[model samples]
Target: MKKGCLIGGIVLLAILSIALGYYFYQQSKTDPVVYEFESPVYQEIIKKTVATGSIKPRKEVQIKP
Candidate 1:
């Protein structure tokens, strides 16, 4: 009985090891990464600004209850 158990345990371990090895081997067979790039284009940019009137801050404050 002991010998049978030992052989069975060894066979189970061997099967597990082979399964893991095959999984990693398949994982390593994936395709490599690919990258795509485009050239930069030049363009003229115009900026304009117009301002009128004055700005002022509020003068009221309330405390929380």
Candidate 2:
């Protein structure tokens, strides 16, 4: 019947629309344009340093009762 044909057409259109949307979504995540450029200048960079140690004394004190 004509109703069955209409339903079939609607289903086909919906499937095609979803497929095209997913295809375009996958294409937007690529970085082809941003990776082609290089930096123009370079500079000297300094990093932070850390020191760790323990101190010792010559005599020890005792408490009397």
TM-score of each: 0.47, 0.46
Worst 10 residues of 2 by lDDT: 30-39
Whole-model lDDT per candidate: 0.94, 0.90
On TM-score, the leading prediction is 1
What does candidate 2's lDDT look like per residue over 1-65, in tens digits?
Answer: 99999999999999999999999999878766655678788888899998799777799888799
Which residue pairs clash in candidate 1?
none
Q: Could you give candidate 1's per-residue lDDT for residues 1-65 as a string of tens digits?
A: 99999999999999999999999999889798899998999988999999998987677677799
Predicted candidate 1, C-alpha RMSD:
8.4
Residue 62 error, candidate 1, Å: 60
